[model samples]
Target chain A: MSVEHVVSFDRRSFMKVATGVITGVIAATSPLAALVPSRAWAVDLGALTDAQGAALLAMIRTIAPHDALDSAAYALVVAALDKDAAASAAVKSDLLTGITTLGVGFAQSPESARIAQLKAIESSAFFQGVRVKTLLVLYNNPIAFAHFGYEGEAFSKGGYLFRGFNDLKWLPEVPLADSGPMPV
Target chain B: MAQFDLNDDSVAVIIGSGAGGGTMAHELTRRGIKVVLLEAGGRLTPADFSQDPGAAFGQLTWLDPRTQSGTWDAAKTSPNMPAWHCKTLGGTTVHWTAATPRLQRYEMEARSTYGDVPGTSLVDWPIDHSELKRWYVLAEKRMGVTRRHGMPGMPACNNFKVMYAGARKIGYKRVHTNYLAINTKARDGRGGCIQQGFCSQGCKTAAKWSTLYTEIPRAEATGHLDLRTRSFATRIEHDVAGRANAVIYRDSQGNEQRQKARLVCVAGNAIETARLLLLSDSARFPKGLANGSDQVGRNYCHHLTSFIWGVFDQPVYAWRGATLAGVVEDENIHNPTRGFVGGYHLELVALDLPTLPLVGMPYGWGRGFTDLIDNYRNLAGMLINGEDMPQANNRITLSSTGKDANGLPVAHIHCDDHPNDIALRNHARQQGTKMYEAIGARQVVTSPGSVATHQMGTARMSKDPSQGVTNPYGRSHEVPNLFMSDGSVLSTPGAANPTLTIVSLALRQAEHITKEMAAGRV
Candidate 1:
């Protein structure tokens, strides 16, 4: 299957979950009420409560904080965890226990306070699991790709041969003769 | 297209279809020999390959459960997945970054040159250097290696430019894009590389040499090859005369089927090749086939490997070229003054944003680790591929309890770094750090060794039957009709990558087999 197809499918499913969850949670307390106004995203959560999912997203951002990264990139981690939790009861329990152990006000806390809270539980299974999952889901997304300046797949666009495979303007130019003689 | 019957006892059965088996199949078939080729994984075309690292890993990697016990870093980091090889039709060739370097003349005579390093089982290869060189020339020509056959070298990418500047700053002269099997210009019916950079994900353009696109197709065109995909060879059955006459394996549907053979060639990589031999124990030769010396699965060597990443102030765009197109060859000499017996090569490497964070750095959270990810565009990476000492204790053995899907015991890999290996790694790391520092790198991070890609030395070749598993021709000392046509027959692991040598040896072995068959020896 094509990578574009897989990525679009993930985006479609996440949008479906986000619309349903936001509608259901709006009547009660908004789970994103604790997050910063500009950074809050509409996330689709299945096994986690709105509060737990919000706290999980906050925890992932704290683990690998990049101010340039969009909040939607961090939300991908929550969506992936929620999907896994829906399929496996063990995953749901781990996410619930880990979010609860981070204690209340984790989503509302400042960056420094959140970092301090995560440091205490860094050795715990819940923390390690979250750290690994965040690396897998957060960094591989298109939003993260843009923030990090990584050009994804090149074959569809005719590869990088003409585009910038050797376009390093900062480095000194290497002599063509240094590459040795060309084939006859 | 050739369909050999189950009872076609005149056919040569080759197990596994990577560099060794795949090349052997084509060589034998073109010579009008009937062959049955068994592959454990399904066939995949260039269209099936994905540029996504994680998705492609799942698509190509051999994920069979294998246990590991070793002092090597892989035991701690990649515990369950010890060696990284493919299970697909083309085997590891589908996943290899095509750097083809021949073994040095001195490297072939390890025992004489190194002077018997204690705690090691090093031996000189039975075949002389000149004989191997003759085959190396043929292998290079057949694979269309860039530097050897007057083929133009690959164009340097941003990653290679960074490496070139740093290496030059460190006063290393013998540095270039290295000899790659990827076509620089359209040749051998394969297109020239566009430098897409995800080479390990299976070259989508078929520019890089892989048996899947090149050798297997050519062999099938000969109409003398019966290529069986998803046929896992479980045991090499022999008659009372101790000749390997049949192979019992599981078909695509997991049904037990036997394919009779005039002779057998096992090239299932070092791990599985040794396992199959050990599993084929019989009443006549109880120790195992060709294991009277008890050295079937010993002296396992996965080259001393580590990734060194240089975080520069400006963008380097490391992931825009051929993944392993640059090399430093000055260190590939045997100099005891460097505090190591054998030597190493520093090849330019690049991992995508997703894989870089996972395997490129140590496992840690917070700003200290995230900062590396932040400067992903400015990262220049190089990998140390060095020769490691061959120890008798470091080996692959069958697990007593663990069983595969077909109810056969799994291969357990056990390795511990020899003191020489540790010393060589330290020296290489120091030199690598110096290279980057000379070019004013902000920070140099040495990542731990990942899963082994250059695995060798499990079933070694020796002049005497008492010392190793196979003879110089990769033929079993006891089972005359049984041969090994892979990196498993390397008596010692050299500093260079093993693909070119594996293909060369298979080519040489095929000629011998043809001569022997014509002489009515079998």
Candidate 2:
């Protein structure tokens, strides 16, 4: 995929960006930028290597992993990391600590090795704290997760009504019974 | 006349600015009192309301739903049951389903109809339902409540026809939709409800009775009321004589500030109200302001709520209209045959949205589920929102060492949910499951434990000072100028939602305070 010949898919195409190219796919000018915080452009995340960014994405992906429908989870995490890189030193340090927790050599490691590292990190108190903080802000923000994965909230969209959208159904019926009051 | 400075200099402070708080501010300020209305939450507008439940869960709700704290942890806390509340300018009314059913006559004195259950503090209200009838009408207008009257499927009158007919077949009367604080047609400059399935998420269209659209603005319009949002009251300031003289608060910027007032109103919800008064300890009143009887945070009650969800063969489009349209009240009064002191109202509450199926539906696996999910449209359900008898053990106390960011002690709450409450819930659950079967539901699922929205009874009102924390007029029995007007003021927990009751009492209390002021009694 040459930069000049970047193929444009419909709104749905953004959901299927490749796994390894997630960072580039979710860069500032990419569709995934919409998922990051509104003030993400202002923060400086400090200097991070490709390995550091990959490790951060792997950790976040485990927390809100992508489903089979190509939810583009990895892309969204990359965008968030890219924006976070521009944040203050404190935020930068927190991001580095999070990346290092999943093991700094994540980019060079195999997928299985990276996954095992993530599993170990999950048991630690520091990772639990980071997981809670990231999820709290992400779940509350619809666009952030919507760019990467499906949320129960998105079922309200028109497309979700019927056509086999898992959550939304058109004119879904629920019957009622007036059994009067209980025999008390 | 008994006047101590009520002019521009006299800080006429009204404690809360929700349904009752905002209404009181409008009423008092309209009569020319410089008022300061304090709300512990942030100020919000209609635009601030989101259709997304996830967003609403964060801003309007007290605790964030996604966090582990959102779920009740029985292992960590004693007597664990997560009590849900709203922490916004509109209070719980902001997220309420807008069912405005008035209490039936028997609800006030359930103790007389059925023998009291031990370990329960069931009592009669000092005032009767008729006393608040006129006030109910007033509250209806203030809230801009509307009804279709005799229209078909109008909920109270018409929609109950099908359910009532079934009930009659089983020897019970019909049910009907009660009055609700929602717009039927555009009234008082707010749009009518679009039936958008987002009332509980905070009505984004200004179609519901949230303080954002009504009394708050009316109070603000008078220029007599100054609302300080995000200002959590740390404690009530006491005078030399141990009367409430001022309110000490922590502002949004976390700065300490004190405002002087002739009379102080504590309208924060039950838990916050008790915590504030108890924290306001002085050398003259060490036990806490107006808490000499140690009844400030005692006698807490939340409804023994339960639900029956049914999966039917056809779609009813349950989420199309109000989450609640009508209710059956036959079992809502006292009935000893059921072995319970009080009764419960079976509300025909419909469900919609993805979260309902995800979070509320019964969890299981396999082939049978596909068929049930295919018929998700045909699932009508009934929920039991029954009144629970108050108990002293169900109290809110302060943790000795735990504190919030502002240095205020954390509210350590515990409740020994009585066996009678459990028994009543069991009976209701059985009845609900049967009703689902009667309605042609293929499968019925019941929630073992109940979630409650109607929290009350911490600071009760009574004619005798020893019997209750506040007098009939909501004034403190011990502190002359201190007043309370939230769920904490209910002497008896009614079967219906508590927001309507709280508003009516606040309206009555305002009248009481103004009358006393006019007669020079303050």
Candidate 3:
């Protein structure tokens, strides 16, 4: 379930119930909704605080290990989580709780233990959600796409006609045995 | 179209304007019939579609909170999103990979051919392949399906190339860039596919045959179709004589409006169609409308699917022309020697880096998960499209307590993998692994499988009313004016893709309805 779900399910009863049927309601969009990122357009969002952001970023790097990725790419994921937490205080609390518990002193832990710490929490809802979002946000970044040898320039740049559309070097040839027209 | 008469009962109200309803709108309106096409999502142009897979998923997906049960991985992997269908105006026509393979003859008569496997609800279609052949021709020609009637096939992409090489190595023939509805050389006024690679996530160009641009637009030009986007159908009301006469739906503004109908066509795909039937419970029809047979929400079939990715030593650049370009049809037949009654097709499929982790392995996280995404360009994929046996227990039922954004009870999709389905999937996955391994793939990853594509056979067609909901003509057995225009009318989930067959059935139904109306059959 999503963070909004966590908020609604947990907080539905706390709101003043309509005593004797007369009713009213109020609501607004979350804070940190601003922070529109680049053309790939992962929303630029703010975590509640810096340490929260740091803890989340540390968690993200562990999910997708990349020496090639800039520090900004990790920030892309942190921005999303921060926004997610901003929307739901419960998700925020969950993030902090997970970081503190899953981290096992992440700052001081050896590299192997850090990896092991992340692996322990991989199945948890927070880790899974963060991991899913990280994969989405990071790959959408054009810089990340470039590093991964994926160009979004297929049809836009001359339709892959002159480019390597038919190029498959490693595999064997599949000859056109039935060169005649396909049957209707 | 302007606000249609709320009281006018002449208009044929279609409850979903994607493949079936959109095509019906075009076909019926041209033949001088008024249609009120109700789509449960907004009408979006290509400008609204995002190229990013994640964004596109949010922009296009239904994302409704439907409870899932039984042992299908879809319940565990994508719990909220049971079926991967778009709620938008074009329906899943927007989300299709456009593989338009005709159903093989043996597939239509599964009961006679495959025989009865234990723990399955296998049955024959009311109509045979020969009965559907002429209609299939009309559908193929109209959609400009490649490799048919001299319309050329889509150019081979890197993924298709690798798939072909693998097929050749495995001593299998009949490998080709598919007879997809996507264009090679611009026909039907739509542009040829330049293939920006997000075929599963709405087509960027007007190249793919989504009704948003193709049939719906043409229907709009005839001035007989009132395409109401985001109008969710709640119930099918009928006359005391048991003829469907109206559709009660919540309009975009959340006001419930009952559109009086001369004929009510339920084409909201299988899940919604079945759910709507169950929700429309009445005093006369306690079970549901046109559900006297108790088969309105039974015999659900999602193609037994598996995604296998091959990580090669060199760059395959699988993300090229189309999302899916090639098919190995040699295995799309029943060879009982393979330990499975039915067979499956192995098609070349490619997922972007973002999609690979979430769907390719939704629950995994480790060195291996990172490695899969790290070598995205070097990966080639094969998706097994197997013929799933329809189980009476696997169905779309209205939840006892759970409700939707609207106060109506949500549709809970319950599916347990039949043993036949498991056998077919396992066999196909092994074959895919071997195919990849033969082509010098470093490692092969078999996904625990993912969300469904073709959802079919909830309200199936059969010779006996006790067995199925619709007859050979897709008309309801109980209600004369009600028709099932989507995959819900399908008796079986054939090995190949189901869209072409769905389109063919719609065309044939249109002709039958037209002729019956002329003769005053009702």
Candidate 4:
């Protein structure tokens, strides 16, 4: 039998449970959250002040713009940062250290100054690992940014989050037909 | 029911659900045997898969921000390189590049052709390539392996037109796309690949043939396979007789549960397989379960892969097709000229990520970014996937300091390429340089050695119980019904992606087990 058949097996049988429990608990519209304070986990962006969070969010936007292309990755990072206090702490420290080392103080820096500082540090090996890693985290998995229009979540709207198999490329032609920074 | 007293009561405990587990579950269940295929990862629905390279690495391969800081985290914790694996339901097959080239004739007989590498267990396969031919065809058919035929590059895909043209101009040996276990046409309900160019993340559409899409669901449909998602197997349980009995696993909630089975199959990836075996020690088999010979976690090998990139003068969207499309098999066989016993497959690959060009390139970001962009098209590159000779020193050992939440010893790989590995890599580099120059590359750069992503070879197969963990059928000689079906059973890390071979071996093992079960042997 296929997935179609299996999904249909207990489909309607769980609808009441889905609405009664799953929806009442984790659903976005759950009014129950207000009643159950114990259910609400604390979310803190540690080491990063609210101001720092805003500043980094803005900076990431410039570095990786979300014009026609997807910027959900950026929002996911912010969202993740918003939820996990400890994770945001490491990110906050890394970014602050990177920014300060590049001579751009957080509170005093202009938008242009911040961009310039980020760009300068982008070239350095000291910031290379952290910066690249941060981008990878933010862009690839925007779980934190699920609230925002994180495209990744939308991409997984159908349920294929970790679905298909990877096809191995045993043979490939060299000096490829085209090579350029693909459109973002 | 026959009134014969059954010694073994294993309903079915199949490990892994990639090529092997999937195929086995289908066969065994079809033959009326109840199966319990255990995968130590979450199950993914079709909609959960994506075609975005960025998302692929994020969701498919094992890199999540929640646990990205740890040493075992593939996201940030490569020993020294940018390699990783998937921890999701489809296993690493979710992130595999579905290349399915069969083992060459000599790959099965390397020890006979050349003397064994001193510290390495460079032995030939117990079963020859010919033995796997039918299974390879079955795997290819099941996975929807396809060919582009005459459309340029390797016949494997359409994306290699330009690279194929270039390789031909340079007189490099052009290889046809051998076989891929992804759907080119809808087979077993999976649609043909949409070519979203992001097979790595997981196929969002039911276009790609991951086990989650094909075998897992198929097994689930049979009512014979009991899949428990989020159930992480910590160790194997044995009867007082010291034979295989059950598996001890923990739930996502960190609570332990013991599931009994007469027989067990450890189908976790190579590292996890070896780690599980070593951790499942008993007084009777104190070295580890099925490790009486102490070869349970020995002879680990991964292909010695290295990358070479050249700046091209055109705007080829390397990310438009699957990340790879063409291959130069000029040196897939051992030759006296190359002075290496193993062969390497070269393929044109695009970094496929904007940040990949930025971060993957060896140079600094400024120069590196500009250089890569300036000749993105000209930057057609090839990676030499050199096969590593199995070395005992290059094995997976339990870390003295690290343990997972479940208290199982995490896998600590003591992997360092051998001198011959270095020599083989250098030879591939030289060959890549020559190929690049011949292909009219204005400026070609050969990269230093990189960590191989295709991890394999722990708990390898051999004819003798003294020399190998599993016999030729992937069943442990120490335990009558215990089995291994992942890359860990590979005798040698053949010069190809191991996903297909692992599946084929699993299929073969399933056949063997079914026949044995009929005779009441298992």
Number of the predicted model whose DockQ against the real structure is largest: 1
- DockQ of each two-chain model: 0.50, 0.08, 0.25, 0.06
Candidate 3 chain B lowest-lDDT run of ten: B360-369
Report the lDDT tens digits of candidate 4 across residue range A68-148. 322233433444444443456675555566545645354356657766776766766445654454445543332222322
**Per-model TM-score versus the true fold:** 0.93, 0.74, 0.91, 0.75
* Candidate 2 docking DockQ: 0.08
**Superposed Cα deviation of residue A86, candidate 2 (Å):** 15
How would you encode candidate 1's per-residue C-alpha lDDT over B366-397 as one tens digit per residue? 78889899999999999999999999989999
By TM-score, the best candidate is 1
Superior candidate under TM-score, 2 versus 3? 3
Model 3 residue A62 lDDT score = 74
Candidate 4: lDDT of B313? 49
Off by over 4 Å in 2: A1-184, B1-9, B64-81, B146-172, B350-378
Tens-digit lDDT track for model 3 on A55-94? 6666777777876655455666676667677688898788
Count clashing pairs, candidate 3. Answer: 1
* Candidate 4 lDDT over residue span B342-370, tens digit each: 78887656565433433345433333333
- Residue B344 in candidate 1, Cα distance off native in Å: 0.4
Better of 2 and 4 by DockQ: 2
Error of 1 at B177 (Å): 0.6
Q: Rank the candidates by DockQ, best first.
A: 1, 3, 2, 4
Ranked candidates, highest lDDT first: 1, 3, 2, 4
lDDT (0-100) at residue B105 of candidate 3? 87
Mark the regions of model 1 whose C-alpha exceeds 4 Å error after superposition: A1-41, A109-124, A180-184
Off by over 4 Å in 4: A1-129, A134-184, B1-8, B63-77, B80-83, B147-159, B354-359, B373-378, B446-451
